[model samples]
Structures are given as structure tokens and as C-alpha cells.
Target: MVNSKFEFTNIKCYCPVDKFCHVEYCYLKSVNRSYKYFSARSNIHQNPITNFTVNLALLKRYNGYKPFLYNFTVDGCKFLGNSKAANPVSKYFFEFFAPYMNANHKCPYDHDLIIEKLPASSMDYRLSKLLPFPEGDYLFNITWLIIGIPHGNIQIYGSLS
Candidate 1:
């Protein structure tokens, strides 16, 4: 595979539990001609997160973003505990932001969850070689469910060429 280009076009974060949890900031930043950053911060105001699940959906731009390759839900706590044991497809996506995220340990997260300054290059290898995607627009729809209730939704938009 020749050097593929990956860029984050936009990011939108929505927290349903506004009083309990809210997104502080979410944006895509361009540092230079070839470097871009994806950053987000969410704050939990109530009890710490003990049990949670994440729903991941990959969509491609086919007549306005139709579901494509994969979609599944995994226990967030379990994945955090042993990422290797999680489904390979989900594990691959999780690994994309694992190094930049602060929620790496077990449950009962008391502090803010943040993914700060995650460069697009960090995911280039996975998108190019690990599980190659056709050159097109794509969206990663990720939802956070706390104890069965939807807490937040993060939609990440990007393109490969």
C-alpha cells in the first residue's frame, strides 16, 4: 500500500445526560500542511462510571453515509481491563485512541475523560495496512452507554485518499 492519507474533517459530541455528564470540547485542529489533531474532553459530574458499554458503527459515504463494514457493542470496562480479549474488530478501533486517552485503567472513573491532541498519523498504519478501507468518506459513530442508558454519542468524520 502506498502512503495513504488520513484526515479528520469534523467531530461532533453530544451528551444526553446534560446535568450528569457533558462534553467540554471536541474539535479537529490543523497544525501544519501534513499534521492534524483530534481532541475531545468529557466531564462526569455525578457518580463515577463503574459500568459502561460502547456501541461502534462504521459508515461509508454511499448516498449520505450508510453503514458499511462493522457495527457492534462491547463492554467498555471489559475492554479496558483486557483489550486483547475483546473482538478483533472492536479492539482495532479502540487501539486507535487508546494511547491518547486517559481512561486506560479499570472502572470507577472519577476524573475527566480526555483524548488530547491525537494526530491523524497515529491511525494511518491501521487504516492503511491493518484493516484497509477503500478511499472514501467515512464516519465512526460511537455511543457511550452507562449501565444500559445512552450517555453520550461521538461522531467522527474523516476521509482517506
Candidate 2:
């Protein structure tokens, strides 16, 4: 649930009707839902290689962050879940994907991925590389992971390494 305190914009709904959006999000990729192609609801093709940063806490709430309509992809990215107790559900999701991510990755969350605020940021990509993540593969967007297989040439800027 989005807080009344912060006002967001351009919110689109891509969730299935059955599962509690989050859990459904997990099943959609593996279960092979209708979105075999890049669907708008999934926001798959909006890969801006965003120099803009992601709002991890907002992502935990609305599944994506939008202070305004702008680049919302996680190409060159950071993983806040590994260090702080922010999004527990999202943290669990990442943990499930850990083996494939990186061997040296450090998970931050102590509890079960609770939806809380961490000292998060937006557009802070310069120092992210030196922060230590997996070699070869960078912290690509969580949307990339959620969308599973890609059907077209998705230009992810951060994962260039």
C-alpha cells in the first residue's frame, strides 16, 4: 500500500488477479503466464538504462517507484535488501535468485524482507560499481528478473560489464 504522505505518478497495474500481486509476481515468470512477450503491464520494454536511481522502499510497496514518469529500469543498480531490513518479500525473492546472481553478494535484510524504509537513493550510480557485487553480471533491474526471458534486444546499460 502506498503511503498517503508521498504522492506518486504514472502508476500502471500489471498484476494478475489471483495471487497477492507480490506472490503472483513470483509465479508469473516461471508459470508462463500470457506475458510471454514484453507486455505493457509488465513494463518490460521501458529499459532506459536509467541514470535515475530506483526507490527501493517504494518498489517494496507499489512494485515500482514513480515520483514522476521517468526512467524506471534497474540496469546499473544497487541491492539494498542485502544490507538493510527494507523489503522482506523482495529480499526473499532475491535470496531465491542468489545462486544465479553472484557468489560474493552480501544480503542485508535481517528479517523476512519487511516493507520498511532504508537509507535509499535515486540516480546514485557512480559509486555502485566499486561497491562489490558479482563479477560479469551487475545488479540488473529486479524487473528483468521478474520478466524472466526476454523476447527482444533490451539495452541494459549497467550490465555492460
Candidate 3:
């Protein structure tokens, strides 16, 4: 078995439509060699999100960030209701952090979406065993769209070795 180590290097959040939604906080905290956490909070100030979509792009740092294995968009509501059928790749990635997020339910997200203190270890099996990836730096570029309009973006940067 290949012994792998995964760690989050940074997290960045941006809300283009600040009047309608905004990211309160997004950060990666490392307490020790074995303890690391990633957190992000986004507030929806407008009407409840009845419909939304997410564009996921996985990029690897070769000479620079280049498209890796996956790049697709999935309907957020559909994914929340039936993940496997919506998109297996997105489901796999979503499951990596779903346990720590409060936005797992179906459409109409009326409350603040929060992902707090998501331990990095939660992704060990998926990143190392289930879908083994080459040792390198990676970036997950995720864009949130409400009714086909861009609302926010979250970029998660990490490395596997």
C-alpha cells in the first residue's frame, strides 16, 4: 500500500454578488502535524436558494495549474436529492466534506451555509484509497450559481504526498 499524506494549504472564498450573498470567513488552520482543519461560512441575504448549480474544476500544479481529471457542473438541488445519479465524480468530491457542512439538504437553503472545523483526516480514504491521485499540489475551483447567475466562488488548495 502506498502511504500517503494529505494536507490543506489554503482556502479562498469570494462572493461576487455581495448584496445577495457573501462569504463570512474561509480559512485553513493547522494545529499540529496530525491536526488540521478547514472552515468556510457563506450567508445568503436574498431569497432562499430554491435553485442553484455548482461548477467543479480540479486542477493540478504541473508547470502551473492545469486541468486534471475532472471538470463538470452539477445541479446543486438535484445533487443534494440524488447524488449518485446527478454525477458520481461530484458526489465523490462532495462526500469528502459533506459530513462537516450544513448545506447537505435539498433546495431552499434559507440559513447560513457553514462548514466548520472539517478535519483533514476525513478525506484520507477517498484521496488515498478510493480514488488514488498522484502526489502533487491540487486546487478545487468551485463556483456557485443561483438561477444560472454566479453568486460565489470557493477555491480549495491542497497537496498529497
Per-residue lDDT of model 1, residues 108-155, tens digit only? 789988999889887667897777778899999999998788898889
State the weakest 10-residue window (summed lDDT) of model 3: 82-91
Error of 2 at 33 (Å): 24
TM-score of each: 0.94, 0.21, 0.94
- Model 1 off-target regions past 4 Å? none
Give the higher-lDDT candidate: 2 or 3.
3
Q: What's the lDDT for residue 155 in model 3?
A: 91
lDDT of all predictions: 0.87, 0.25, 0.87
**Where does candidate 1 clash, by residue pair?**
none
TM-score of 2: 0.21
Clash pairs (backbone) in predicted model 2 = 53-123, 74-141, 82-107, 82-108, 83-108, 87-113, 88-112, 88-113, 88-114
Worst 10 residues of 2 by lDDT: 114-123
For model 3, the local distance difference test gives 0.87
